[model samples]
Target: MKMDAFAFGITNWAEIDRTEHQGETGMAYWRTRYFGNYPNQIRVRWVEYTPGYRADHWCHKGHVLFCMEGELETTLDDGRKFVLTSGMSYQVGDNAEAHQSYSRSGAKLFIVD
Candidate 1:
């Protein structure tokens, strides 16, 4: 798919390129991508968090996430916990919460930001 093209119908992830995303500490790392939702309406990617992985910082960005494999957890600054197992999904509006994610056993998720 063309990077500059408008997002529309189906596009396969297997055919899309990926980039490694780094954090402030680099300990919370994952592969990422963007596109497939029309211009800049939405960005999509698959996140792969290794076992014992967690994000380097609390994030305030919103996302629509679909659990594709394994398990992962999202914690709100207020100590709320949200877990995503295989086939489980979650969503949060951008910058709605000061949250972070962790995976005791790793996880693969379909994410739209």
Candidate 2:
């Protein structure tokens, strides 16, 4: 989706499409749904991971993530780990460094990229 710089918008989670993630393995399945083509090419989405879920690839891009429901852990290639619970937030740059995530139980997050 594309956005017009001058436009304004409003939305509710129920109104957006929930798209299944493509590609990946492990019991690590997940789903993401977002609305709006925000300015500066920003994308906002709601992501949920199943119990014992782990991401397929290490992400190198920057993101602003907020934990909305459940627990999730993010581990950097350098072995740094961070655990986030509800109401917690994390922000990182698009440093070419690698990072991956997992959840022992399950997790729901609001993410901006």
Candidate 3:
């Protein structure tokens, strides 16, 4: 069967409640299993955060972050900082360093793994 046959859906993040964490604020996540099976997975998520909000220092197993709207300021464990805006994307390998993200005027992101 075609992937799209079993993997089709839409989500509105603005209607979901925000998840809060220490050092992180005004954040929210909406996850969906779109395609593939367990072990071999395909998932999509929408992440957002408001101004002055920050994420804890952590790394992903292996994933890519695609900016959908607004701006994001990311700081890696190695002290490297990146300023990302809409239409921007980046990768975080298994060996990726821990990092924190903050926003000045709120931001939205799409995470695919």
How many residue pairs clash per model? 2, 0, 0
Model 1: residues with Cα > 4 Å off, grouped in runs: 1-7, 23-40
List per-candidate RMSD values in Å.
4.5, 3.8, 4.1
| Candidate 2: regions farther than 4 A off | 1-6, 22-39
Q: Against the unseen true structure, what C-alpha lDDT does each candidate score? A: 0.73, 0.74, 0.70
Candidate 1 lDDT over residue span 1-113, tens digit each: 23466536776667666566654323333345555456455566777777777788898878888988888888999999988899999878767888888888878888877
> How well is each residue in 1-105 modelled by candidate 3, as lDDT tens digits?
112335555667565555544554655444443456755656666776767667755654556889889998877878899999999987776666776788888
**Candidate 1 global TM-score:** 0.76
1-113 in candidate 2: lDDT tens per residue?
A: 24346446665776666766532433432334334454446677778777777788889988888999999899999999999999999988787567898888888888887
In terms of lDDT, model 3 sits at: 0.70
Candidate 2 yields a Cα-based lDDT of: 0.74
What's the CA error at residue 1 for candidate 1, in Å?
22
Number of clashes found in candidate 2: 0
Q: Which ranking of candidates, highest TM-score first?
A: 2, 1, 3
User: Considering TM-score, which of the candidate structures 2 and 3 is the better prediction for this target?
Assistant: 2
